[model samples]
Target: MNIRLRSAVAGDYDAVNAIIREGQDEHAEALPDRFARLDQVVAMGWYRSFSKQPNKEIIVAECGDKLVGVAMLEMKQSPSFEALVPRTYAYLNELAVASTHQRQGIGKKLYTASLAWARERGASSLELNVWEFNERAQQFYASVGMRTLHRMLFTDLT
Candidate 1:
C-alpha cells in the first residue's frame, strides 16, 4: 500500500517505457498499429530528451523504488486556431499506470502532481488527448473534471 510519485530522472526512462508498454497492452485489441507504434516511440523519445528541456517534465510513480506509472507535461502556447484563448498553456502528453496498480490512485496522484508542476511553471491551461474509442480513459478524465471538447481523427499513410 506504500506508493510514491516524483519527477522522472534520466535513469527512470526504461521503467517509464515499460509502464507504457504494459498499459498499451491492456488496450492493444482496440488500438491501430500505426497509432500504437508512433505513440510508443514518441513517449520513449520524450524521456530521452528530458535532460535537455527545462520546460518538459515527466514524472514517475514508484512503489518501494519500482516505477509503476508515468506522467509527462510540456509548456505549450495556444494554437492560432483558437484566437480567443491565452497563449500560455500546458500539454499533458502522456500518462500511463501499470495494470497491476491501476485504480488504486496511482494515476490520480501522478495527475495531481503533474497539475501542480504545470501550475508552478505558469501554465494557464492544461490539455491532453485520449483515443476516441477509449471510453475507460474518457471516463477517468471526466471523473477528474475534464470535459470532452472536441473529436480528433487520424489516418495512416503507410
Candidate 2:
C-alpha cells in the first residue's frame, strides 16, 4: 500500500476515532465492561485538547484518500522519581490500524513516523502500553524493537 503519514487535523477526528475504537474492541477481552461504558465520543473528545498541547501530535496514515491508521504521541519528561532525575521521552498513547488494513504495514509506517518525530524532537526514548490480552500487539511491538519495561497485573475482585 502506498501510505502517506501526516499530523492529524480537526477534520480527521471521526475517522481517527473509528480507528481508535477498533483498538478498544480488540482489548475489550480484558475489560469488556469498561470498554462498553466508553461513550465513543467522550473517549475521543481528548483530541480537542491534545491538538492544542505543545509537543503532542496525532498522526494519521492515509492510503489513497482514506485513513487506514492513527497514532497519538506525547513528548514529556518522566514523572519525578525520588532517586533519579527525570528524562524526556515520547509516549505512544495510541496506535490503531483498521481491521481490514492489517498486515499491510500500515501500523509499522505509522510507528516509524512517530519514532522519527520523537527523535527529531529530542526525546531520549519512546514508550507505549499494550494490554496483556492483546498478545498480537505485544509481539508486533517487540518485532519493532520495543521490549517489556514492566508488567501491569490485575485480578477481578467482583
lDDT of all the models against the reference? 0.79, 0.85
Tens digits of per-residue lDDT for model 2, 1-158: 68999889988988988888777766675777656633373245689767898789999999999999998999988779898688999999998999989989999999999999899899999999888778899889999999898887778788
* Number of clashing pairs per prediction, in order: 0, 0
lDDT score, candidate 2, position 57: 90
Evaluated with TM-score, which candidate comes out highest? 2
Q: Candidate 1, residues 109-129: lDDT per residue as tens digits? A: 888888898889898768898
**Residue 118: error of model 2 in Å?**
0.9
TM-score each candidate: 0.85, 0.91
Top model number, lDDT:
2
Q: Which parts of model 1 are misplaced by more than 4 Å?
A: 26-28, 36-45, 80-84, 153-158
Q: Candidate 2: worst 10 consecutive residues by lDDT?
A: 35-44
